[model samples]
Target: MEKIFTLFLFLPIFALAQKESIWDLEELYKTPKYEETDLVNKKGVKSIFYESIDYKGKPTKVYAYYNIPTTERPENGYPAIVLVHGGGGTAFEDWVKIWNKRGYVAISMDLEGHLPSKNHQDRKNFEGSGPSRHGVFHDNNEALQDQWYYQAVAQVILAHSFLRGLPEVDTNNIGITGVSWGGMLTSSIAGIDDRFKFAIPIYGCGFLNGTDGLMGQHFKNGNQAYRDNLLTNFEAEAFLPKATMPILFINGSNDAHFPIPAMMSSAKAPKSKTYLYVEDGLGHGHPPAWDVEESYRFANAIIHNLPLMDIQKTTWDHSKMDFSAVVKGVRPRKVTAYYTFDKGKWQKRRWNSTPGNIKGTKVNAPIPEEATAAYLIIRDVKGMSLTTEVIFDTSDKQTMK
Candidate 1:
């Protein structure tokens, strides 16, 4: 009788707890009742709620924050850029904003166990830190078998897959960037995944752990027992061949995690295909002064099809733009300006443009108010183009909600 009474007493409490459970992401993501203001586009930032995706038949929810260039209507389909963060860090929303400032779509994917969804309600943020690397490499331990190496690899691939699936996102201009542990995954993704058009990995090195004893536990992108060899197994020199797109490898001269010479050998690409930035006294931080700015500029160039050294103009009010034509054969020293909406009436706006400009890479500029759309008119400048494109964005998106 006492046992029966105790059971009855505990049952309702258990039932009540289940009813009020806060850990259910399904309820959170499915509910469109959330305050849309929380996801509103700010001047340089914004957040979004993405529905769950099927990863290898398992239902998983993903939440990402992003920033996109100012647009009246989400473009037909914008390009994409994917950001992967280092270990122990949750989804990096900042990278999304970084590309947004450059007029690209940025998508940041958070794997499980890091950042809790506002609804996650439980604290497991850093629980999988060790297994994240070990499970993929020495993942034979049965107790932690599900924490397999491929799990992380799958997480990244799925992130790419998610980007590829968005209708408003151009599937052709996919790019990937990662830091530290993320850099390791970036290499693995570039090696196996062919969909990427460009790659930038900061502070990532290959084959060091496979041969070196100190960093061995972390060199996993696969299980050694799963028939395929380990990714950290090959030196950075060997892995260079797998990267087909242009790559900018940024690293601090003082980075403790990856040795410079070994990393350089492994990261080798054709002379035309790579840019290596070495900053003295800077450690493994991604935003280090010397390289971070350069990397962002590089990303801008790679994404926009705009040359890095030119003046860029953004239009206000989404007006149809028309700027003055060149002075015929004067080698484009000064560019004139004119604008009108709806063909109202063409009026010349007083603007000064500098000239000589290093093969017309730069023209002297004079400011013109009411400039409808901005234009760069370069004369007789031979320049190799870097195809810059925005590769990811969730804000103002027309893709699946």
Candidate 2:
């Protein structure tokens, strides 16, 4: 292989020409600058204030809810996870509590420079709306440091560092997950920050403007110059290739906020090992679409070195779809194939499924003539299930399934 090299200004020797990084993470962490204050302890967790810098070099403080297990933990410490909420979401205490119940130390922080307080539901929440200044998107021509993404991604990494520093957290077992816009940030963070061993990004992947989804349309609303600037710099595609950890892309098959094709693009663009958890007719938001069982299952596999049931390969022809997977750890009672002819506007689509022919861990199914997309589902005897991303027959020129 040929080695590529580059020359830096004022340096005589040529250095390896590595992929250009959108984020100067080293510079962001250079000062170790942040302030922490303890807040009220509630629901088996301790909330606190995690202060850091914004894009404008101003001192900014965001709220976080963190908790250590009350019960006995492993000798080293408990596995920890940092949760970044989507747009309009604050530092939800409930998110922390959910993980605490799962025997993991957890932290949730507000990225919008909001104080984690109480929400309309009266749960401990962040006080601000959206992000600090220009919300999620800002001027593309501005210096990257002064953009919303720079601060948001930095804040997430800083939170990871903060959680790792806690005595009760097992740094080696740390992971990160997020929803919606937070999911997008999670993808970028996974690419830039190699400290996280695993990441789960729900309903948010990058390369938005490339898809025909709402976000792409949203980008089109901006001037072409700004759109081009964003596509070149802040989009997840630019950073995901650098991801060194395992990532699971979980989302609805028909998400209104993020299109399936766009999600696929982000998942495929990354160089890291990727997993999928796409559901039929799954819509946006956390409740019905967020599969906590699968997320924890994947996390446990990573943290404990347990056997994992995962898709090794999937291929589709015009009439048949085939699946190959490693199921060494699980004894599935049933394997099913799901398919849908409905395309576009995932929220309004309906999906149907049928029993798949499972020869050990290999699954084969007949694709309906009208089917546009299909996915495989393996259900263990214990009722736990794992899924694959929507598979399409790219060989066919027609768009309709």
Instruction: Identify the candidate with maximal TM-score.
Output: 2
Q: Specify the highest-lDDT model's number.
A: 2
lDDT of each: 0.44, 0.68
Off by over 4 Å in 2: 1-24, 27-43, 117-142, 289-291, 317-331, 380-384, 393-401
Q: Any runs in candidate 1 off by more than 4 Å, and if so which?
A: 1-59, 71-77, 116-148, 209-229, 232-240, 269-272, 286-291, 306-401
lDDT of 1 by residue, 28-139 (tens): 2232211122532344555544444333454444444555555442345666787876654445555676676665677775555344333334424331232234433454
Number of backbone-clashing residue pairs for each candidate, in the order shown: 30, 5
Clashing pairs in 2: 117-125, 254-346, 370-401, 371-401, 372-401
TM-score between model 2 and native: 0.83
List, residue by residue over 200-278, the lDDT tens digit for candidate 2. 9998887666455566566757477776666566677667877888888888766777766666666766677787777
